[model samples]
Target: MSNITWSFADRVVAITGSAIGMGEGAVETFAAAGASVYGLDVDAKRGRAVAERTGSTFVECDVTSSAAVLAAFEQIATRHQRLDVLINNAGGFWEQNTTESISEIEWDHVIDLNLKGVFLCARHAIPLLRQSSAGRIITISSLAGQTAIYQSSPAYAAAKAGVLSLTRVLASELGADGITSNAIAPSAVLTERIKVVRSAEERAATAASIPLGRYGGVDDLVTWMMFLASEEGGYMTGETIAVNGGRFMS
Candidate 1:
């Protein structure tokens, strides 16, 4: 690890799905970096609590609803006037069934959350991000998007693939405007959610499979996010940084 530190002083960063999990981690990370952070999530109570704890602002917004997304961005714009970094991290994988076993509702829900949500947030964040000298759009994707994973649902894989494509397009289109777009695709991250779901043996097996002999953590992601949002990372765009402990190489 480099001894150098990255600063976000006076920067404004916006994150989606900020109530818990990785989103909450981002709030803490950015706030610690001296950035004014704003977190958006449908879980008002938890989101507000997280914001208060992390010294960030929280907005109640559902990524699936375009109206809610627009309204939230409008509020951010009103308060901050500019957004330096926008992280699209609001997504979930509920139904991990095979194609034949998955229902239409399940498919739609997964697609809406993982894929459409990225579009909704990006659509509203562009103008504000463009105003910043070092604008960044960093999205959360999955290893499943690049290749089929046994534990993931078809919808999740497809939606994440869509996110990568959208990221590339944003990078190409927004590069001229001094904006950079990128993504992070993590695998077997040992979040609290993962701890609850995976048995110790399963986790051990997973860890063994990875060359690093351990699962990734929120800090692993935080490192990449901070780097991409920093001045030193200005040259990187349309790239997906895999924080999977070398589990999958591309």
Candidate 2:
């Protein structure tokens, strides 16, 4: 990530799934850069703790629930009246199953969390984003969305692919409003969840396969996110930046 510094002073930034991993890193990074950050997540305890450490606001929210999403954005609107950046970072899948092996409930849950949540957040964030001179919508997607390089939850991959499509839709619809919508598709990011889900041997093997010869840290992805939210990134939209250490090239 280097020593690259971005000043988001006076900017109002909202990030979903801000309790842990990449989301939590973003909350701290943005807050440190002088932005007024709101960290939203379903885990109230960890969310609040992250907020306290970063000096940002914490809103308990489930991005999957329309009502909860509305309320969370409402709170942001009441406080800032506008938002400069919206980071759709809340998403995950529990079971790794084939398409046919996956149950309906599991499928729905993954889709809702990874895909629908982005839609809901962006849907409500558009108005507030319009108030900013250069509104930015940055979504976190997965390499699984781009390709089936390895075994993964079928629903997770599908949902992430949907996110990429939705990013373009938002960009197309909001271009006139000066809102730039983009997505970051990352792989081999060494988050806490990755540590739990993959055995050490699995992690090592994945790392070796990457051209960079290592797994990416949270900052690897978050740094690109910061760039997309920065003024310099305002000119670009509807594009997906692949940050996978050359693991999968398009």
Candidate 3:
């Protein structure tokens, strides 16, 4: 039998969007498994509180801004000396009356936060991640990244699609550096924002659509993340694990 214990005893993991929901859960889980976790979020209060509770570090960061992302990465180096994992989970939805009604500013914000933020964070975190013996970059894509779904807006869909593309490119490009890039495409999950957006009936309808007959929880996604971040996942790169409860399968 395999001893599937995820112990990052001397490892550092930097998770963006780590203030709440999936990010917050991951912080707690990873920390419990012996990882030195660091969180980056625009919401400093929630971020710091979560970090304190989990014994992780929190850094105030607006992922959409390159200046903030770079500064956060610099601080990570100073504190932990090296970084092992980068979870690019910062994203949001934006649209106007329709695709036609979307302003240039609106379009930019969605793309910047969803797509550009991942690029910026990975770019800045690369130096430190590369220093680790087994470096992993895990980006959070969605069912929107895989196929057209009515859940997210147009810009969010496009940016998440770009995240998948970036994952493949980086995996190939960074292979020699011993750095692996992968993505997780999660289906509808019952998170705080999701609870507000989806009613009980609507959620039931969506869950019924999945072959698994349920929504994939945060833990479902975290299990894959833990796998990809582990040393055993060295050869498993450039892949996107879908945690949609078989919502849309290939």
Candidate 4:
């Protein structure tokens, strides 16, 4: 986040869950790089604020709804005609619980938002992405996807694992079309949701355990995303880059 410079002058980038947290960070990052950024989220108020700050387009879209996703892409296509990058950053953890304690409703809710949402966005954006010369699809996963090294809802872990599989599948299927798909698995990032869910003492303890001596931040994830979307990342596909500061290595 220092002396960083990357120019994506005419690239069109779309980010899900762009209202806050890592998604918002991405919007700001791409906008600064001169990309035509589009922010998608169900929270219109916050999304609009992000758009105002970054000068990106804000679209009200619920990632879980196929119709909403389709309409949003239609709007993007109408404006940009082509999409260079798609970041599936919209995800959530329903609650902290084990299999026996987790309800079927909770499982479905978590899976739908975290995993299904990624599928829906990719499904709609593939056509637009194919129109670009260097298309990049970056999905935000979690260290929980690799191993059970952190305390998270069982549903969260399962959904993120599914995301990793989906990313690889997309890379394999879309490679012939000159598209690249990748996943970023981060651990203990300090986003708005994390600040609300974990206490200060808990966060300090978690940071102490990390080999980097601090928890990851939104900028760290965004920087990786920028690289994956850059021309230098053209040859990369079906890879999962871990950004946990050595919390879990696989």
| Candidate 3 Cα RMSD after full superposition onto the native fold (Å) | 2.4
Model 2, 25-125: lDDT tens digits are 99989999999999999999999999999899999999999999999999999998999999999998888899779999999999999999999999999
Task: Give the alpha carbon lDDT tens digit for every residue of 1-250 in model 3.
Answer: 1134778888899999999888988888888888989899999999999999999999999998889998999998998778999999878784423576677788888999999999999999989987989899999999988998875677888889999999999999889999999999998877887888788999999989999998877787777888899999889888999888888896
Please provide TM-scores, in order, for all candidate models, with all chains considered together: 0.97, 0.98, 0.95, 0.98
Alpha-carbon RMSD, each predicted model: 1.7, 1.0, 2.4, 1.0
lDDT of 4 at 166: 99
Span of 10 residues, lowest total lDDT, candidate 4:
1-10
Where is model 1 poorest over a 10-residue stretch in terms of lDDT?
1-10
lDDT of 2 at 159: 92
For model 2, the local distance difference test gives 0.94
For residue 128, give model 1's deviation from the true position in Å: 0.7
lDDT winner between candidates 1 and 2:
2
Candidate 3 CA-lDDT value:
0.87
Question: How does each model score on lDDT?
Answer: 0.91, 0.94, 0.87, 0.93
Q: Which sections of candidate 1 miss by over 4 Å?
A: 1-4
> lDDT score, residue 169, model 3?
92
